[model samples]
Target: MATSSSRIGARLLFGIVLLFPLTYANDNAQFPYALTFGSSTLTASWFTKSEGIKAIQFPVDSKYRAYFEDALASFGKRIMRRGEWHVMAGDELVPAPPDTHNEDTAVSLFRDAAQQVSRNLSATLGFEPTYAALTLSSVFNQSSTKAATDAIFPNGMGFIHSIKSLNKVAPAACVAHRLDLCGNLGRTPAECADKDSISNLILVLEYEKEYLYVDLVFVYSEYRTFPSVGHEMLREFGEANREKLLKSMSTYDYNRKLHQTLNAFIESLVERQLIVRVDIRAIVVAGGASATAIAQLRKLAHNAVGNGVVKVVDEIDPGLATAHGAAANNGENDEEIERAAEDENIDDDPQSGDPKETCNNDAIEYIFDEQQPQTFDGDKMKEMYYDKDAWVSGFNSLMMECTKLYIFADKYSIPQLRDDITSALVGHSHGWGWWPDPDIDIIELVYNNLPSSSGLIRLLVLFTAYSWSSSPNVIAWKDRFRGFHPEYLLDVLFAQAQLLENEIHGEGGIPYDGMLNSCVVHEHLELGEEECRERLAKHSYIFASLLSACQAANA
Candidate 1:
């Protein structure tokens, strides 16, 4: 027994040595904790729950179990014993795939579906298969001909999911990096075999030479259970019968909510000439679905856009397809996704209520005579206009236009245009003689439209913070605060903290206007700078307290 234990320990140590490199590699890689669906981004913690066998049934008194438990403890892993199950069993548990208040799941499904379609199309057309998930816009806005759309190149290498094989993306061989289980917790090599337990729906696409499989999963509310096992059945409804079903919503004997969601989306696309036709072979319903529910969905899908035969299968792990597929393809950049959306035109803009164009300002507009007139030739170009109001207006307009252009470029995969616009914004901010200060209105406009990832957004925030620090009266601080997103506010505060910490002095030791204005904002409802001082002090204290609590629990 002693020799056997020594052998086990030796093997465990060997496994650890083999695992280090994988751990180091994945330590820097980012996982998809949040998914974007239309305008909303939903958090998905379940997608990344430490990859290991949870709730493994082991003998309560087995000496091997003790050894494994000790190993897990060394790695800071908790083991749920049989007795603990009794305690936890009584506790009300939230269902799997927690966040689903918005249309995130639906959008995720559509995005993956569209990408699969694009891949098939690429193969058919003899183009390189793209790995990126298409944006909602790209699916709807796809050009009528390959010749027209094919001219534009793919933005960058995007994340791709091996629908048929999760291991292709996750590489089950790297289980050591996935979880620190102290060399698989003393389990034998046979015991640690890949379970392939995750639920997923397989989508098979037939190409000329071979078949491609696209696995999918839907994130549905576990709380919303089907009323009966096989009570309701829904058939496909097309454009011809859509109005009748929508108008008589009360008479519908199906999952009306799900039906309407799909109905509205398909209707919107078809109305805009985006989705002319769908050749969907299968629409598998999985994850907390019953026979009746699956049938009902099939009917709903049929009625919504039922042009041809669409089969609906009831399968397990439908959600796995989305979660695993997304995790596999998490490395895709924003531009590739945007281009996909632009081409598809599935995701509509709320403000514009139209398809976002892939082409940039220059591409859309023709220079009839580029050399004819050199406007503001030589002498006039050098005249530095210091009109604060004019500068503010012109720069504000430029930012707004750039904001649009930048978003356009990002969305349509026009990297060149995006880079040009970013350069222009940065150059204009630094080089131009007059400091262009955008007032509350312009600030709000950019904040609302531009994504946090945008370079322009960062520049605007820094400039605004500095402007507020330099001269509080340059912009209406109070009004601006009312419209600023919480994220924007937090970013500004973080910037302010960094600026103050660096102690970069202005003309004097006096506090800069940006930091001062930030302090003033915090100091409101308090005497002098009391609130501001408390905020700075409390930030660190609060974080420390939380960390201590986490540590205590771990211990």
Candidate 2:
């Protein structure tokens, strides 16, 4: 009795229903395993819902270790050493025959080694896992690497890689950024820029079953031990200077290029609406140089994005993470599984209010003295307690007091008090003297007590940046800069750059006067603009002259 279209729709629905169980069955039957190809070792892992995860290392017998080491040595000696000067041409390097031939041979040798390891793993497990995944070290060229992997695992899922596996293990709504810091061969063009250079070298040598720091020097294209170079440097230059040197090295061209690559990838993903910035939660570091790479990448990420939330996960067994991650990627839907578990634990009762609501609706009650009955009563009370004249006489004590109050307010969850203290402190910083400088104590207090996102912190940084030229105290704090939070220092540098940029463009310099605008430092909570303005009207007289100057400058 149904129409032709309705009959077609019914048939399609029935077909989908019938196929659903078959698809699920296939997923259940899938026993995915992964093998990670590394310079010194081969790592394999398999995952099953019932069994969880099982990982094994190849070259179980010490003699077999030579095979992997020789393959890697050949890759470095033949491909990397020669490919350094070669040019890329549409996925093919020019001067093709010899270099290309060596590259293929190197990849094949590596693959053969991996296959032997896989066979051993399969034999040990009794049944071989058919759905296999493979992840290669950064030294392997992606185009050639894919061919090698395909050959190793003919029925492989090409899209499943270590990074995807890392994402699977990471917390929800977060993705992983892989930073492979290999030993011999530099992977990308950026890493290859300074091949085997000692300019910014860091090494961890395996000796007597313990990893020890190795400082080496490159003399006439050969590496030689510098012999306690780090210790000597520390003794000569002191810990502070050594730390500074290390920090500077983190931004070297190789690391800079890596950071830029990561930034570009993140921005592209954002542009494509694939992921937001917050979704980039972890930088999974792998390889022999992981310890060095993590420190450098942490600094770079902090500089690039202030890195408040992003974590740098140290993969102790470097290549094993990739193997385990790949094995976890089988036909299973990790997200869906997690979602289902979360749903099962969720309460049936609806939440009292939207948890994500940004605005605090609780009314902030400001009780005024009945005898005084003034609109600016709160301001007057703050002035009386902190003493405005004392701040003009010597701002240190007042600054400290205000900072403590701000910290207290933050602790007690009093946004209104925090806002009031912020406005008062900023106004005083401008009016106290020509170049009123906050000392190291105040800097430490704000940074230590409040989070980096605090407006008060931003205000203090801006004030420091604008006043640095005239403020001798701030200039003198250079020695103590290392003690300051890295994020705080980065913020200050950015603030200074912004002020300089404003001057360069003939923007007539930063409007320090504009900072007097109460609303700039005020927290309105749930109040509408009109309501916020009405509330702020009471304290408007406090910065009337400064606000007038700001308005005139803008006009």
Best by lDDT: 2
Q: Candidate 2 — which pairs collide?
A: none
- Candidate 2, superposed: residue stretches over 4 Å from native: 1-30, 59-97, 100-108, 154-281, 290-300, 307-309, 313-319, 331-555
**Model 2: ten consecutive residues of lowest lDDT:** 1-10
Q: Best by TM-score, which number?
A: 2
lDDT of 1 by residue, 461-534 (tens): 66656655546563555674766566777777777666675566443322443212222222122223443333
lDDT of 2 by residue, 22-56 (tens): 33333333465566554445656555454444455
Error of 2 at 415 (Å): 52
At residue 499, what lDDT does model 1 achieve? 64
Model 1's TM-score against the true structure:
0.24
